[model samples]
Target: MTDRPLPNLDHWIADLAPALGLGDVDVPLRPLLDLTRDVAHGVARPAGPITTYLVGLAVAQGMSVDDAHSVVTRLVEERLE
Candidate 1:
């Protein structure tokens, strides 16, 4: 892949979701992205996606997305202390 700039993430998701049969999926973008940044910075860059996957699993298991995101962010933030 070239280093071309990516499209807006919300746009990408909007296009991709229905294509994957997740047309009704609603993502809380800002909070989850914030969690990604916090995990990447406080832990390591590679941990970001892994942390996000765990959050996704929690959401899939019936936890609220916001709660899952907040739980990871708070854990990482407290770790930085």
Candidate 2:
């Protein structure tokens, strides 16, 4: 790949969550996992519902996987918006 700047790509991956941070793994997976947890936390509210799904939505802010899923489930069960 050519050394070039992209639209929404950042090099912080190697800075914050490097492969070594994950463990003695052959693949660079820490950055990926860290990013995931990041999205899961960054958008998390103490409570809420109907948050984004697709990993492609990796850019949206608000509601984590756990919190968002919980609120959504509750909304479905309790029949609340």
Candidate 3:
């Protein structure tokens, strides 16, 4: 239950994405990692996963991943200012 990512993250995601029924989807791992890190640091540590989940929902509802990331990043930046 550590926060550290697996050493072989690409392999892990390859196995995990299909298992989660997203086999055909290309996950933007680096952007997501960056988003979570910002949310965790700029907000609360516990907010990281929640914010990521919301971004996923936004994408599913037709928002582009980049747009979703931008929205969340903006919110974090504003909160930190």
Q: Candidate 2 on 1-81: residue-level lDDT in tens?
A: 233554234444444345537333232233334434444455444221223334224323553455544544444445432
**Per-model TM-score on C-alpha atoms:** 0.78, 0.26, 0.83
Q: Residue by residue across 1-81, what tens digits does model 3's lDDT show?
A: 336665688788788889998886677777888899889999999999999999999999999999999899899999999
Stretches of candidate 1 above 4 Å error? Answer: 1-7
Q: How does each model score on lDDT? A: 0.80, 0.39, 0.88
Give the Cα-based TM-score of candidate 1 against the true structure: 0.78
What is the Å distance of residue 79 in model 3 from its true position?
0.8
- Model number with the top lDDT: 3
By lDDT rank, best first, the candidates go 3, 1, 2
Give the worst 10-residue stretch by lDDT in candidate 1: 1-10
Model 3 TM-score on a 0 to 1 scale:
0.83
